[model samples]
Target chain A: MTSSNETVSREIQLAARPQGAPKDSDFTLVERQLGQPGEGEVLVRNLFLTVDPYMRGRMNDVKSYTPPFALNETMTGGAVGEVITSNADGLKAGDLVLHDAGWRTHALIPAKTARKVDLLPSISPSAYLGILGMPGLTAYAGLLEVAAFKEGDVVFVSGAAGAVGSVVGQIARLKGAGRVIGSAGSADKVAHLTEKLGFDTAFNYKDGPVSTLLKEAAPDGIDVYFDNVGGDHLEAALFAFNPFGRAALCGAISQYNATEPASAPRNLALAIGKQLTLKGFIVSSYSHLSAQFAKEVGGWIASGELHYDETVVEGIENMPGAFMGLLDGKNTGKMVVKL
Target chain B: MTSSNETVSREIQLAARPQGAPKDSDFTLVERQLGQPGEGEVLVRNLFLTVDPYMRGRMNDVKSYTPPFALNETMTGGAVGEVITSNADGLKAGDLVLHDAGWRTHALIPAKTARKVDLLPSISPSAYLGILGMPGLTAYAGLLEVAAFKEGDVVFVSGAAGAVGSVVGQIARLKGAGRVIGSAGSADKVAHLTEKLGFDTAFNYKDGPVSTLLKEAAPDGIDVYFDNVGGDHLEAALFAFNPFGRAALCGAISQYNATEPASAPRNLALAIGKQLTLKGFIVSSYSHLSAQFAKEVGGWIASGELHYDETVVEGIENMPGAFMGLLDGKNTGKMVVKL
Candidate 1:
């Protein structure tokens, strides 16, 4: 469809706080007039939007590292876009940049907030929102630093086919981790982990008990457990942790939407007994390591040691459905919306 | 009491496993004759015995970093003793040393296992079990390394009048922490923290809600939290933690004897939101830093920048009661038994 220059901008806003699982009514789509880019600002035509687990925590009104999205305000998210107009110095019109432009077709953002990407020689610009951006950094920092992985250490990644997990398993292999095991929600995802991501062993969490499966997969015991889905996965990893083991707790997707309080890990005391170190971290905390991460992870990808995948949903209007599917484990790899 | 040499050879063993908390019935005070020290071994007459929270986790028959105390076997603990007989070249009969000797009056230990403490003109040998040994090293490693304290950061210590907490608060203050707040179970203990240990503020947890008191004590929010008593104290610290705060999970005494599983923290998710780091550590993991710790903490103690207290119970026969009392929060600082 050809649009006039005076056409209104389409946007999505938070309608209500979710009780347990978010419903469609929790978000509302509305239209507003597009404004001119102010000084030191660029106007972008958003091409793709990202849906992630971390966004669920942002929807709640409770206090967090970053403020919660105000009710009725535009729902915020990371997006990749092409600059339509620029008053900013470095960025020019038609340049592809990654920014937290929220769930909208067009955004006027400060130039500093947008990172200019050279999508020519390395990879596609969408990878910046998926494997090469927040998700990739989450996997790299959590595994390398928080989990303290050394070569020959047995590593396990839960939610193996998800954005962060996929990258975590691949990075573990690249870092010479021994016996990289993974768990996914479906058989297809499980196969994808071992076949595509180079995981030594992969289990479908829905097929059987997690503790039993973890034992079968990692017979000797796990040294580093990268947990995306917490609950039973955490309990299993704790039971299977060897002495001096480490767990990098990046996300606990399983307990995020629970109406009642979640149960404590059955073997939580094992942390002290095994002298294990369990660290809960967010990717932003280690942002200072980004340049180093890009150099290392980017090189690994170039060498074919690291690989990534994305599940794209067409159009900005489908953002809520895409996010709902993400929480339901319906999407494989990084889930994004193409507008 | 000076007695026949034969009387000094008796040892104590575990007779049975206690159902909940350990009981005197679980101990068997056997009178086995002493054996001659092997080559590179020494005979020790135990002086001071350590009764710590970590021992509680070992009471159950389970795999841990250190194996559980076997039924009808000696219960191991850190002890300071004087070498009575030595076949080792480096150790003499009068040398004061520390070793992992059990609940016994006498022990035959390998020379390498026994660490000799050259008695300082101004310090007592018993300091090895309190301010200069495991507890002190624990405080140093957890506070400086795990919590990553920088000058002017506000610090909060739980179980603040106990062994590790007392040292942690003093060391943080010595390191130029802007404010040091502590929480204990009673008015006397709270007073001890503020008056004797240099805490900027101290509160009796029994007074009211812990989160409320913590907020009042640390109005600007705590930058570093040294957690010794987990459960409510941990929850309170999480709420009062500042942005980019660090939490050192040294011990969790409150949950040691819970008959029923403890409740999950209401604000546990805050760890991710505030970009907070919660690191659970055991002192043995950082044993490599012992010499560095000794240099720094020893200097602090000698210069009067740090102070430590010990709650000594006399006689080896009273150890069970001393241990039970330690769990009951009766001890002011390091709970040591002088035999």
Candidate 2:
């Protein structure tokens, strides 16, 4: 029998390389003993975990900006947890922290790897995984820096109901974009983007071809495109972009889980005539902007200038399901697994 | 009977729109009577006319940076002519002038529109069509200004034996590019690029695949790509670009005559990860740089540092064939019709 003071942690490991959309068999839930925090490590009891589109790229065994997840090892991502035991300086028990040890109930993380979070009653800890976290910074830097957003620009964003794109649309509006348009997979998500997120117009991509929908919604043509879902959305943006248009290619969620390589955008030749610019980026590449992003967006949240939504799962065992659901367009905004 | 003092002009008019490549029937050489020069106009006897790739875009009934060539009207392009009768104070007869009145043996042009060329004993007037004219400014602006070429950059130029690409390669080298690679259609053009143009390496694209050939030529990858031919060559540039690589998209000659819409570059997605920048430009957009370009490149020409080639097609009636030959890549550098 286990002693009352002896803690056992449950974790999920990558069981197999996913061929397409990840199935339940791709992840395995394993229970292990918390060996004890040593040296600069801390024993973290995870409170919340993040399930994101970018994680899909890590599942494939290919070299990219980041390395693929090692098969049969514990998968990693963004998470919020409490320190149960600390062997490192500047960290103590009962301290809430943000870390990158995902899909786990507890973690023994290096103190330097975990950042202390000052808990607030108004803001949820999981916000660090969504609007106030990596996703938020991605929206900020991608729109302003990568795409070179100008005031009064008509901006269009794909995956507008998701964590990053939702913030992208909102920030564009707040930053004085003349009009903001968005595309989502479902009608409810479309409604949320236009009604709640203040997008000038929103379309359910499943209703019709994106090229037709984009042309109808943004008749004057878009100046900036924040591309999250690639494939047809990218092609549509190419068709709808005006001269000197810019695209911040933050993600290609639509093609991430695809088994076969995606098709080329047939209309990209228009870019030559229009003088368009497209720049791709991962959020981690702009970590230095975190403090500035947090200060500005955090103010937006606190002042009711910005609103965000969350779909939370209750257990760590459901983490894989939440991730798969995100890829399937099941989440309206941020997807969080509350352990 | 016509008076011996009068000049009868032979002009090539766009008789019909071609379904694919322009045919002989698409052009009609008609004789026109000329009247005395008006208050601000000059009577010009055309000497040499330029046939270029961009003219193909103007042949179609589409709105672009420049106006389309009207059916049954005389075609317009770069030309060097003698001012036959000048009624304006600034100009005089016997002066060689440059104007946009191509495909004609003589022209009645506005005096303000015709820029008198200061005769240089060292440089041919046709050099204004190939190197000292719009094509020259296109290469300079596309390479240095548009692509933001930097010293030590490994540059790759497509259509390298052509007027624009040959100049692009030479300019990049003179600007201190680490390596200058070029691609052409024939082995003779390839040898011309490497041997005459001083390209670090040159390849005949017909030898094999552009992707394989480009990788073999620039194993270290390219920092700047001057895209004159867009197709497999553009796709190859995307594949061969290093991080932060820049491409000055000058023209898409390869896709200009395509019956159907051109297909997109398949690996354009790689741009996101590599942080590549591709910018398209038309020469007219940078017309302000002409005097500055002329001052610099004209010196290069006068000093014999810049060597240029021309395929001269004699007679105004052969203008159509010369343009067709340019589309066919029969010309090594600039294709000009001497009327």
Candidate 3:
């Protein structure tokens, strides 16, 4: 969908709070008249948007790292856009930018808030929303830094076909992990991990219990586990952890939408005997590492040492459905909505 | 209970493995002929024997930090004794010593495994089995090193009336912790914690729910948690943990005798958002710090800053009952049997 030429901006607003799994009706399409940018402000036409699992946390009225999304207001998230007009000295019209003005086709943003981006010959602007953006930084810092990855350590990753998990497995291998294993929801994604992403081995968690599959994949046990899907995945990872093992707890997509609390790991006692360390974190916690992250991971992508995939949904109207679908595992890799 | 000139040594042996809570039938009273000390060995007439919760873990025929106790065997643990006979260099008859010769009135032990005690008249020989022995070392290393205690950090301890937990709270306070709170199983134990052990506040976990009690105890949040009791206590600590909080997971006494595996903290997700670190450790992991630990904690005791208690049971025949009582929370601090 193109930005309205009639001076009105189309945006997605939270019509109601979700009870469990979010439905399309929970969001509504609305329009607002575009106003001229004031000093240090710019008007942007949003092009590519990110719909991530963490957005689910922001939907709740509970205390968290970020504030909750207020009902009847335009939902905001990460987006890449073109500056239609600028009142700030550093930026101008036609400049491509990245900003937290998602769920809308056009946004009146402070020019200081929108970061100017250079269109690389080899990299797409939308790639900044996935591989070169928050997701990539999360995978990078959560593994090498937060989990304190050691060279030649065996690594296990859950939700391994998705944006962060896929990058974590590849990064582990590239950084000298002895063996890298990934668990995905389907045989195709599992095949893609090993065959396409260069993971050492991959398995479909749907085939059997995660514990049995993990035991078979890494019979000797894993030194590090990057957890994206919590619940049984976290429990199974605890079972397969070696002595002095570390687990980087990044997300719990499995229990994110649950109306009731999820069941906890029954064998957590194993952690005590194993001298295990489990650390939970958000990527934003290590935002200072982004400069180095972009430099390192950017080189990998440029030299084709890393490969990435994107699942695209069309139009701002499709954002809510894509996000819900992402939660349901209907999409692979980074699920993005292109307007 | 006197050393029988009759040449027979009274002992408590594992009669069978326990199923749930250890039963009386699981243990048996036995007798052995007292043998003369061989070369490189010493004959120890046991004075004080320690019965710890960890012994319950040894009863199960599963791999753990230490080997499982074989059926009908005299269980080995920390004890203080008098050297009745010595056939090794540097050790003499009638010398006081400490050795892992618990559950028996007389023990034939390798001299290399027995360390001679200076017999500090200021401190009882039994105090070595509690305050200056394995339990004390466990609390020292677990709190200061493993938990990475920083001055002014708010500290919370679970199983706060037991041998290890009691020392942990005192150490946190003596080291300049901002506030110290403890959770125990009974009103008497809670009273003893706040009234005698110098804890800032103490609560009976049996009096109310742990989460509610914890929220009331530390309204702001806790910076460090020394976990001796696991299960719900761990879950509650996770809830009350501040950003970058650390937990030294010392023991899961609450789950040691559990027939079924215990549920882990369902809200373990809080660890992710708060950048929490949970590290499980056995004291032996830090045994290298024992010399330093003894010097420091011993100094605390010398200054009267450290106080210790032992609930003594007389005779080797009562060893099994004292051990079961330790697990049942019948004792206030260290539970030891005197021969």
Q: Which run of 10 residues does model 1 chain B get worst, by summed lDDT?
A: B1-10
Per-residue lDDT over A1-339 for candidate 3, one digit per residue giving the tens place of the 0 to 100 score: 335443577898888888899998889999888877889999999889999999998888889888999999999999999998889899999999999999898999898888999976777788888989999999999999989999999999999999999999999999999999999999899989999999999999989988999999999999999999988888999998989999999999998898987776777778888999999998888999989998999899989999999999999888889999999887778999998
List ranges where model 2 is wrong by over 4 Å.
A1-7, B1-6
Best candidate, TM-score = 3
Chain A only TM-scores, each candidate in turn: 0.96, 0.98, 0.97
* Per-residue lDDT over B211-324 for candidate 3, one digit per residue giving the tens place of the 0 to 100 score: 999999999999999998888899999999999999998888889989987876778888888889999988788989989988999899999998888799998888889999
If you assessed candidate 3 against the hidden native complex, which CAPRI class would it receive? Answer: medium
Clashing pairs in 1: A65-B273
Q: Which one wins by TM-score: 1 or 3?
A: 3
Error of 2 at A170 (Å): 0.8
Better of 2 and 3 by TM-score: 3
Q: Residue A329 lDDT in model 2? A: 90
lDDT of each: 0.86, 0.89, 0.90
Which candidate would rank higher by DockQ, 1 or 3? 3
Per-prediction DockQ scores?
A: 0.38, 0.55, 0.79
The better candidate by DockQ, 2 or 3, is 3
